[model samples]
Target chain A: MAGHSAGTEIERLIQLLSRLPGLGPRSARRAALQLLGKKETLMRPLADALQDAADHVLTCTTCGNLDTTDPCSICADGRRDKGVICVVEQVADLWALERAGANSGQYHVLGGTLSALDGVGPDDLNISGLVTRVSGSDVREVVLALNATVDGQATAHYITDQLEGSGANVSQVAHGVPVGGELDYLDDGTLAAAMKARRPF
Target chain B: MAGHSAGTEIERLIQLLSRLPGLGPRSARRAALQLLGKKETLMRPLADALQDAADHVLTCTTCGNLDTTDPCSICADGRRDKGVICVVEQVADLWALERAGANSGQYHVLGGTLSALDGVGPDDLNISGLVTRVSGSDVREVVLALNATVDGQATAHYITDQLEGSGANVSQVAHGVPVGGELDYLDDGTLAAAMKARRPF
Candidate 1:
């Protein structure tokens, strides 16, 4: 259905808005009209904010985290333990980890995991940047905090191969029943892994 | 669990984005990060589009539909039946009707229905403009095509009361079971209304 007869400008806004991750064509129009309805309070500020973010935000040189600075706030912060680097698949994953207060160490955002099906090789990710950071630093440990997907495992194995001679020890996050998870809903693979890694009470 | 440490610009974008319909805190962050990651292809274009719309689009004094011109394209179109005006609650509803090719008549956007709880009354809507249009022209019918909600019906009734002596006929959209809808899922009120309004089909 042609739901785009408002005007060229509004239609254009809707088209662009639909490209946003969580928005579809229908919700985009709703958002566009809402913005137009509250032009001074919403539309103008959103436009300005988008432009400002586009211009200021940059990828960190040390880590792959996104911020308004070159090295990013986390990388530049002296309080974080630079000797223990926590690796993540994406900047969002890094943010999730940080929000959980999971680690006091610095982060290394991989940008993406390797996937042969998608033709995303090691070069496509921030692997070289990660290797360089680990090689130069006095890193005691390099934590591989990747997801449990096949691509994540493949990428982790590749990274381990790349850092074979590096001084830092590599370790992956433990797999088990989640903190609030029910035993009845536990999958076979998780049950086996958690059982294997069981410690004495 | 503060998940907004990307920087002020990203944080601000997330805050603004969350305000849009169909978006919440988590989804807004995902959208903001997506925009940042594709600045040239997505972010820049969206920013430009929003600015262009804000600068060019204006509310049509003739009908209340937002457009780049004083008289909206729909209202200015000579092909449409100006004698028959379809009155709707909002510009979005007008667009929906136009897309469906439901009516070839002109439209008058009321902006909203009367909501006594929220203090919305006839004066809050574009009722006087509608009255003036009906009075001045040889308009055969003024279709009160508002939604089927309590407020919508109340507003329609109020407008009918206001246009008592006007020459033009006043009518509302038909209320019945929606096409392709199941009988089991139909509400009692709608079923009764549809049965009452049943015609020789």
Candidate 2:
């Protein structure tokens, strides 16, 4: 009689799942069902991966990004150009640019941008570390890929100001407006061409 | 001049992020970037919540739903009918049934169906527990709300077989196919009407 206690296992899964972003009690429950339905493929592996990551992953010492090791693979890569650094607000932006196959330069993750109203300051970002990175003798250009929002712009300015004495040529992603981004949701060609036609701010 | 070190944080984030469901390296980076752009609101809370949930949550014992408590709110509800158990393959199905707002009976999560190719057996499904639940007194009807997939059907039959001698009537959700679920993507009115005219399996 106690053998049919499916609810007990499910309860454990639901609790872990409900905590995911965009999932409330309802969606979390639904997701749990979906995961349970594919127990062999989805459930156990997900649990294992989560636990593994939680246990093994650590923030890169050189950068603020998450990593299983300290220096991170990219930072340890000697083949990459240490001279030019692409500054981005989040780690995702660096991947996007890489996917575009546009820039081969090294990268700096700012972690997040400067926001005055919400009380985020310079220390919260990776500004100081970035400034130190720019000081290395071989470094050259610094491309800024921060978003175009108010906070994004402010963060951009803060980075530019910090890089003043470093002598690195700073730039932002060109192409007026983004494709698939509102202005709204433009064509790739338009975005690409805009990047090609960017002017100084 | 050293300030920004590109590829440090971004690469680490991608490695960590690529592990999420529906996200490869590309999408994870995109999500991380989006979070960076909205750090104060979306980013911080998301991180805090994830950490909090990871640290605090445990599985519920009674209904198989996730909660901070063992029984979960639904299982603890004495007002719900213990006699009529609505069986579903996942937590999602249970939530969907709840969303439909008609069924007020207690729930039993199957966790998954019997899939031979995937090496899933009855012991894997938490089904044996359902048999025990039915044998207990006061049980009346058991509603099966499985999907219309081949595996779903096979699981339903298996469940019906288990309940054969339990003296309880068993039924499946009837009416239109799901709206977003597509036959393909039916209208709300059609879906609502389908529930009204659901037939016996």
Candidate 3:
């Protein structure tokens, strides 16, 4: 398939594009053609953007977030509550929380959840950094904004144990029916959790 | 959503990626993070590929196919049958045909189909170039391998009209129930076309 491509450069572009999360080989070729057709408007700009991101974007030392700044914009923002830190599985989760305006606190990206089959441990993650942040600072609460998966729960529990003596209170986000989520379509576990964690109107 | 991003470079990358055919804003962000996470392996190579494509790729002067060479690889290929030319609406279509190994002939990309609503006319397409190729070369047949859309058929008819004096056989690819397609799931128009164009059992 690659050999039949118009040019090696274009083929290489498609190959690299297919490596992206949502794109496959077929769609990658389509994307390559689209980029070729709109060279100035889409292709060049995307090229410039990718190059720029490659050159500038860095991991935030403070919160393990990807940013241009060493501490990241969230960590640098003085307006955000310094006393609260939202723990998440990845930078995307951090961005999701920010997009939702769900919290006015800082974020701590754990990179990924603890996976036993994958052999990911506390050392593999940014757990020590998170513990140091909670222990060194006057942080009042460390909120686990991790997903409701088994690995996510296990990771949260591990972090909670690590932050046991750190003065900061460890709390997990609630597991229940999502906003606008239908009860009928939801899983039995979610329905059961929602029932048990029912709040007063 | 853009404003809440960690860095401007990452934000711009996400924005550019979201403009690709299949990706939305959310997936674009996820792609950006994936790129950031695997900077050396994925991000840098993709950037290099894009820049290389931008710097090198050129449209084939003869058939409107995109390649680093002006004539394109297919047009330059001595092994391919120059006697037949497959006409397609876009370079992607040409790639698809090549991927399928559907033909051993040369190709002529039309860039896009004729669209009255979009104000796409003959002047906007490579119809004249195709005519010139057929008239000048020993081309025996010009195959219209366009989509089944109304715009595609309109473009094919328009091209057929323009090739009146070119002395080349103008034929369109057959439209029928696709291979492995079930009659129960096939649309009415496709079923009707399949029935009308029934071949020897």
Candidate 4:
């Protein structure tokens, strides 16, 4: 309770910061203290920028990526190869693929995977929009870059079935252990997945 | 460049987030992405809290600890033993001591330790204010909870000298390896501190 105060807004800020992944109450307290130390240098600009982003960052109508414009940079660029569209779960994943210097064509953000337990389905996703884009356009291939979770695979299969006989090749990207999340902490399900996808199999 | 965007506001927020201790570009990106994903759930409350903290939280008049009121909670609490004041460089250090449940007295926040290289001196610190508090009150002891840095030791000495003729007993906290900072990464000074303060000398 480093920065905790009765009805103090800094306390609330610390609470919110603590809720973030990888940030505990101690980390949140340190962060809040740092902000207080340099209010002009850090806090003011942060607040203004957050407000600006909240007010202005409208998601791209077609791709669902956060953008100032309606179509996003990838969708608007005429020079980019439009025949192939890469479908990703989140805009951050799309950006990661771009950072890797691969996939220069286009993107379709699925919003999230189809988690039946979470009540997430194809209709709940941006898949219907993706289907529309694939069926109405001269697209040659749809690359599925979804994660390798059971829900992710189910979503991929569902999308593939939707694209069947639509004159567009449907292929799912490989599923494997993440470069981050620790292998030791992985449960039995992921261990089985790793074993099945082992090399030379 | 994980979260960098064309917008000046977006770039500024990402830059500020990245500058936080223990938060590099990767962590900052992950945090920003999380914020974007749950904008309404996280951002609104966070923004309001930040604004309110920035506008209201002020430095304590007595101890330099940040607080909504002038004297801060410790200084304000009448039940707290004011005869023994625990002096610490940062409010974080004060909170750490509080978490350990060792000291039950009041606290005095120094803001930072004396550093000649950084042009910080006793005058720059809350030293004179501390001396004033000691002089005016019936305080019997002032415990130094400063970090075991070179500057920390120097500031402790300086404070000891100031309280020498004031009838207040001054004591420095014991030194040891940090709770988290690895031994391999510790500087020579910290290593010497750990060795010199070894048990059973």
DockQ of 4: 0.36
lDDT of each: 0.89, 0.66, 0.89, 0.80
What is the C-alpha lDDT profile of model 2 across B4-101, one tens digit per residue? Answer: 23233444544554554445655555554454455455444444444444444445555565555667666677887777888888765666666666
Between 2 and 3, whose TM-score is larger? Answer: 3
Task: Report the C-alpha lDDT of model 1 over B62-102, residue by residue, as the tens digit.
Answer: 99998898898888888889889999999889888988889
Candidate 2 or 1, higher lDDT: 1
DockQ of each: 0.71, 0.12, 0.72, 0.36
Query: Candidate 3 residues B119-191, lDDT tens each?
Result: 9989998888899889967999999999999999999999999999888999999999899989999999999
Clash totals for all candidate models: 0, 39, 0, 0
Q: Interface RMSD, all models, one decimal each?
A: 1.6, 8.7, 1.5, 2.5
* Cα lDDT tens digits for candidate 2, A22-115: 4456555555545544445644444444444444555566756555566866677688778778888876566556667666777788888888
Best by TM-score: 1
Best by DockQ: 3
Ranking of predictions according to TM-score: 1, 3, 4, 2
Candidate 3: lDDT over CA atoms?
Answer: 0.89
Which TM-score value belongs to model 1? 0.96
In order of appearance, the predictions have TM-scores of 0.96, 0.58, 0.95, 0.81
Expressed as tens digits, the lDDT of each residue in A69-138 for candidate 4 is 6777678878888999899998778768877857878889998999979998778899889988999689
